[model samples]
Target: MNATGSVSGAERVLLRLADEAIKMGDDVVLVSPSGPILQHIHPEVRHRECKPIGLNGLRSPVSILKYGASLLRAAIVLLPLMRSSNVLVINNTLASPLAFLFQKRLLWLLHDVLGNDLRGAIGKTASRFFRLVIPVSYAAANPLPTGTAVRVVLNGTPLRESKENFAREGTTSVIGCLAALTPWKGQKTLIKAVAELAGVDFRLEFAGSAFPGDEEYARELRVMAKESPVGEKIHFLGNVDPYMTLQSWDLMVLPSVAPEAMPLSLLEALSMGVPCIATNIGGSLEILRDINGDLVPPSQPHALAERIRELLNDEHRRMVLGEAGRDLVSTKYSLEERTKELYWVVAASTDMAGKVPPRR
Candidate 1:
């Protein structure tokens, strides 16, 4: 289950997993409040809309009451069907509590480190109800209850052969940042770093929309870019298809101030043979551990600027890192490998013999 049908990183991972499951001849049903966004991607996966009654995660008394009602309603809807299934995989913490009614068949996939106290408490409480709690990264798994049955399954992406050889000798380098326009995403830091590189012949593109109520933050980033000395070189492409556009860039930058949990964009960049420079926090470290990319201190514009310049100046290093990143993704983060692991987890959790379908 997922909160929405929006094409965020988590949602993308769900769609990919569902696609792989269907390919393995398993019947897959995707439940969400929002309309099914995966229909175009995986036409065979069943879609069910259990419309949430009200906004989730609000702290107000009324919001809390509404959230509880929504959970109860969702539980009523899901409990009957889940009890008969061999295994049910929940994508996030919002719907984790519903698993209590049918905890025997439930597995919770913890996608984040729970940045808020209340949510963390709720997640910890819910962890007891799940048969297995799978985190996308070791960093995400560190905060869970000490004795809870836990597994770390790094998110995966489809590996694509890169077209570019990363040999930008004279042409202007294009650096792209693709993530939601939130404060912790650190787009402002990236803009500042770009401003510091005013003398360099490069262009910066910001390709993501702001979350609800964060439009002002997005506007603030655009204003900051406009006011910078290199304003003319910065472009706010607002939300473009990273898969189709990332290959055109010389490098990708993810300067997040907060701990990111296995960003799919980083994987996509690496799969496309694009060298990435990310902030040293959360899953970025895990993603870049064996790769040849660079990791700078989070929220440090000067360090980010220096690193960007260093990579831009060395074309050979960029090519080497890009190649290494592609190889890493192919070997470690491929969809087939992750799907196989997930299938085994389900089979093991359910105590089923050879229930894992043969790979296509």
Candidate 2:
């Protein structure tokens, strides 16, 4: 997107991707509106903040004019940045009714399950214009017209700097959720489930801020947490560092009601040797299992509460799961390895068209 106010999974991936590109001796430039995400980008990368309008449908004449004006502004802002780069990576179609303008060099990093919704329909149409369509997981690649080129590259997390025993050793067990506070993330369900465990020595913590427009939902969550029977146990610890956050929690839960692409939060937890319990939806099933972790039915407080109780009570199981989780991540999800694969995929595509800048 040309502008973003908060960082989510997509932004995390972009940061890593930019870091890798710069390490490989390419000049990297981040073009977006001034936002919180800029703070995380690599220092070597150039930042070109722009004021392009967000994604919207033009149902009226005034809207169409505004959209046209924004597109013109975006084109103007991007012109200087485009000369030194050949490949353009876009996570969403947010700044565009203009995808075709950069058709030959554009790569669509698909992060949604394109299943007939308006966004999906737009994705289906936009797929035709991109040089390569890179979806984060198989779950995110779909419903496009015939012969659309596609590739699925899973997101990755960095391995811990030290294989420190990052496990929680507190007498009071801590259960945490590490995602932005959005209604669809199902934080309320987690709170309700945590409340069911009366007399259990545990604390439920949420470690993220709301995405820009979702502040109201965050407030609602705080209210619900305060009203919960285990009100004292439910804590809102907003935007803590993921590495430090996961280390303090015995168990992590992702209770998403909506489909996910590939969640980096779970990746970070697994990398830190923390066992995760996520609801079965979207990419959760792809990430967690009974072997390394557990998955419960989405939005079910009883099932959620029961599983939480079992894991909190069984220290041996949590340990085994944690070891297995760390092993799995070390083998399959290292950003170092994924960076090579990403370059291979992007390079392979660019080789066919001779479009990407040479990696010096």
Candidate 3:
């Protein structure tokens, strides 16, 4: 798999696939712009730092130049990886659209829904280009691609086995906000919601880091907390270790102001059998609906708080939803199952001259 170096929702998915591939006794090599954040891979898995491509561009003209230059460097390195392997998998099409253009039978794992407006930091022209070009290019290949050309890989949680000793119950009513402390993540809105839940006894744990040089947002959160009635209830467990953070929470709250393609945090929470309260925007609603928990309208702090309050008030409801979530995850979001399917997707494409093959 060829992944960009930076840690984001997409990269974590690739890491999970690497772990699963190694566990199943397959030869897996994780190629990235750099090393990974979670370094828990088996010795059989190879880690290589491919020549950095698109490492230093932010949707400017310089970005186009850097992107092209980086890919050129990556091409020199990727050929051997592709030659040595039977199938090619990529996180997204940005780096290796050529792989698709050249009919390499690539499996592009899609994290977000693509429209004109949702191209990360890229500008309108580039976004339009990608939206227009990617589908057409993939369709031109041998095994005529389908929606399955882009596999939607969801995050999987580790199930804790039932034990004989009575389990000491941890805090069941936790408001877990796992997004970064950016304005779009709606940290302030969540804090306001907690403040509104003044008399309610609940704990709010913020689990993520601030963007580069955005300590001011952290200060703002502190100030907002101090102003709120439940200010003392909010704790910032800044930049949590993924495993530790998942272990510590009973439920997760995702209140993104901006539309997300898919939130790895929410999926991770669901995997751990933790119910989630998220806004009905982007893929959050699509993924969270009818399985685990409530979906409130975006920017409605009172409504968000109320949904959380309902879960808190009814332990039976919480357990039922959480259990349903676990079952849904087991059936739909198992990492091993997804990767195996992904490999087959790539293998099918490879053998069929990049055409998307019909299901048997």
Q: What lDDT does the true structure give each of the candidates? A: 0.80, 0.77, 0.62
Sorted on lDDT, highest at the top, how do the candidates line up?
1, 2, 3
In each prediction, how many residue pairs overlap at the backbone (N, C-alpha, C within less than 3 A)? Answer: 0, 0, 6
Which is the winner by TM-score between candidate 1 and candidate 2? 1
> Tens digits of per-residue lDDT for model 2 on 1-360?
434634788877777777877877777788777888777888998888777464444567897677667767877876665565767777755553346676666777776666566556666877888777888876676555677788888888887732246444658988999998988799989988988898899888899988765788999999999998899998988878888777788889999987787788988888877888997767777778635469998889999999999999898898888888777778878787776667667767763344364564
Work out the TM-score per prediction. Answer: 0.90, 0.88, 0.74
RMSD to true structure for each model, in Å: 2.7, 3.4, 5.9
Q: State which candidate has the highest TM-score.
A: 1
Model 3 CA lDDT for position 66: 72
Residue 336 CA displacement from its true place in model 1, Å: 1.5
Over 4 Å off, model 3: 1-3, 7-9, 20-26, 51-59, 96-105, 118-155, 161-173, 181-184, 210-229, 241-250, 351-360
lDDT of 1 at 41: 54
Model 1 / residue 274 / CA error / Å? 1.0
Lowest lDDT block of 10, candidate 1: 49-58
CA error at residue 300 for candidate 3, angstroms: 2.2
Candidate 1, residue 123: how far the Cα is off, in Å: 1.9
